[model samples]
Target: MKTLKRLIILTTLLSLLSISLPASTLKASPPHKNVILLIMDGTNSDILTLSRWYRGTDLQLDEILVGGVRTYSDQSAITDSAAAGSAMATGVKTKADYISMNPDGHPVLTVLEGAKLSGYKTGIVSTSPVQHATPAAFTSHTLSRDEFGDIGEQQVYQGLDVVLGGGAAWLKPQVKDHTKDDDGMLKTKQFSREDGENLVTEIGASGYDLILNRDELLRKGKSSKLWGVFAAEDISYELDRKALKPAEPSLSEMTHAAIARLSQGEKGFFLMVEGSKVDWAAHKNDPVGMISEVLSFDDAVGEVLDFARKDGNTMVVAVTDHGNSGLTLGNQGTNENYKSLPAEKFIEPLKKAKLTVKGATSQLKKDRSNLKEVVSSYGLGNLSSGEYRTMKDAKSMDDLESEMVKLMSKRANLGFTTNGHTGEDVFLYAYGPGRPSGLIENTDIPLVISEYMGFSLKTGKFADWYVNGEKFYRDMGFLVEIEGRTSNNPVMVAKKEDEVLRFPENKNFYWRNDEKVGLKSVNLYDGDTFYVHVEE
Candidate 1:
């Protein structure tokens, strides 16, 4: 009996030891200390090979791609800005039209919010509007992609460390008469209209240094928060901007400025830098514009990579949301004579001719005219009348563009796919801790970042209430109630429950009784909580 009692005690102790050892071992190790998400909107992976073949220069972005993970969305052959951006931001595959919302229209928390909650400073920098889909999805939650005004407003509330981009009009008050038609809404009140205060000023009051142009941006400064808006719309593509306005700073300059500000935070920072105009050039089927813009964005990537190298622990991930213009090399065209045309000769004389197509055509008729004189003067030898007529009949920019491509292809390979997006697998490159050793799917991005940031899938509200296949807000301890929409009746208690509740009957209840149920009104709630378990 004494021996049996002693054996039983030993067994009980061993059982407890087994349980405790696993628990101790399961304690997660610290995650990567720093992370940077680099977004290259609509840049295709194939563009890298094409750039080296045609330009004789390998892009810096290509260097990162050599070792990084590359993946595509599950459903679409091609993805839109909203879908791709949302998937990357939230780490889940969603329908194409949704922004930060999940496929079922449920709001999804973003990596930015997760980073912020984890005590890291967060910033968003882009060449496009701050409220544009890519940047907005990472920082704000909205049901529709068209909700720029609301997204812009939400940026202020996010308390982000920095925001740099264009779309000043979205941040400025609308002049009743000057307000343009926005998504079918007539001019009423401007979403951002205020007395003399632009969006920058408002953000500045919240402790951000607002810089308007390149000069101000480059000025050395020490501030935790900075907002720079360079244009009223998406900043111009590199070629167009250089031709149209040479004074603006390049994307690299903006990126450098953003990094300088965000790195100053005590805790590490999360900064998103976007190369936005590549998609626009692709949409216009402008090969020259696409090359110039993509190269310029690559320059910015080089800047970030250099900084991340020095910072050591900072992980930088560069990827495009989708591909545009299905660009591809084609067989050589027959414009052999135009191949030797010097760049200066082709572009300069057009400038000197006061050359609107209309003006040039009218002038060409009066004389075989200074047409040859103008061409030869610019060093482009005399052209036949047939060639002159081809230039004369250029009806749209595309007509003139096609001729230029044929001419330039003789000197360099050119490619195109009508002006539309293609469903091509994009590239993702990452360096630093928590990044997988090899290529990963698009859905894996959020998981990787979350692991690095030390956020368990279980800690997020969405993870438990929705993702875990469990009931929602009720588990968080809030009463579920349905208030009638379009009816002025005061919200009366619709239902009450002790355990987790599901308000399947009222999908729009939270939308109506927002103030009462604490949608945006309060910062904290008291209630029984459900814990979700996720791998770090």
Candidate 2:
């Protein structure tokens, strides 16, 4: 009780102090009409150097080089994408696997959400599942990143103007004999709901143009809202996307389409574009795949920069959430001749490969007898005797791919220290109006973006919009109780007289007695407490 009193006193004093400050002391929102935040997931700073060398030309990202951003979470030094992305989205550091939630497990408004509330069109585009960690942080709030169905559903009701990516499977109910692994075992999948809710149908019914393929996206009719889900899981990597079934679009294509649609609004827009597979390739320690993904992301950056330059009122900021795969130019093999080695030694070897390690691995049979023949067709041949034996004896497909990546990386004289995320500062780039420069914390992202969006997270608006559910309801003469405290789908029930309201966690709707009520926002709970949004 004493601690709570002190906190209340501190808040009151701060509010009084703010009220006493001069008008100039409070920085006004910038005059920018739009803001675009592009995240190249799991990209290391060194990857830029390698990609530039591979392309033999300067990337569009080179023109906007600003400084760097420190990437760390509230709990761990080496942060995962969910926590890292949430820090950038909400301007607060959080625990791993948390999407737009604070360390105390309460919902915090994201920059995109705030932009929407401020009357700006908002959108999110990514190469991975839109419900994947990085994109999910900007679009939804959840305690666990693994809550794909919940995240997918929340995005549909968040009132965004545009959303394009993969993970179509999560929106539909599971089908028998959907897909199988090499062992003929049914792979685990997460579909819409345990009770079978079809969110894709709901999206169309909610007035969004539901697109399924590249042709549909290109020839899309004029619509106020657009939602495209390209694949069952993540869309294919850039190197392997050419042969992908259903003909998915490139990352740049998605970015271009999103920008075109989002900019039509008179009030401006906020869009987040993510090259999500760069991290996936780095986790495999495949330099060729990583380079391919980076180049694709750079192309998307080109599209963003082009739009920002032409508009002149848009603020463009691009940065990676975190670093991965400690990739270095010279490996142990080049220690003695590192300085003497030409750029061709690194660039030429990677150029020979036409497919990513994933694409090559997909061509191999169960027996693995055609490892050499299959890899040779992909321009990754000449494996040493020991390399052949190791790959042949690999226990699983994952093990085989790892070995293949190591051998290919060795041949290119490239080095990778680990297959996991690294704790490092990532390069930050920006262009046009209201671009932040110098070294900044990842949490500073939303604060910077909010400055251009005509809102302030530091003001009383945040506390008023998202309130402590139990206290707020109790103050209104209602009794509150929580159900499913241990399950992913938790609900907070409030009762007063004959009025009863049920708020489900991580969803955009609630129940009043027997009637279903849809909300423009989600109700958040961090295990112990519930945070509800108050409509203005």
**What lDDT tens digits, residue by residue, belong to model 2 across residues 235-260?**
88888888644489899999988988
Q: Worst 10-residue stretch by lDDT in candidate 2? A: 175-184
Candidate 2 pairs with clashing backbones: none
How many backbone collisions does model 2 have?
Answer: 0
* lDDT by candidate, in order shown: 0.61, 0.86
Query: What is the C-alpha lDDT profile of model 1 across 1-536, one tens digit per residue?
Result: 99999999999999888887876476865533667888788766555555454355677876766344333443576777887788888887777767666776665677777787678888888878888989988876566777665567667666788888877767766622222231212345434432233555567777788777878888986677888877766776665555444556688888888888877766677788888877776675545555666777788888988988888778778887878877654333524544564444333322222222211222232323354543332223455677667745655434644544444332343456556777766666776656654556665676678787778543545363323212344454556443332231212232335333222111112222334221221011111211121222
Predicted structure 2, TM vs. truth? 0.89
**Top TM-score: which candidate number?**
2
Residue 8 accuracy (lDDT) in model 1? 100
Listed per candidate, the RMSD to the true structure in angstroms reads 11.5, 11.7
Off by over 4 Å in 1: 1-32, 53-55, 66-75, 175-198, 332-391, 394-413, 457-536
Estimate candidate 1's alpha-carbon lDDT, on a 0 to 1 scale. 0.61
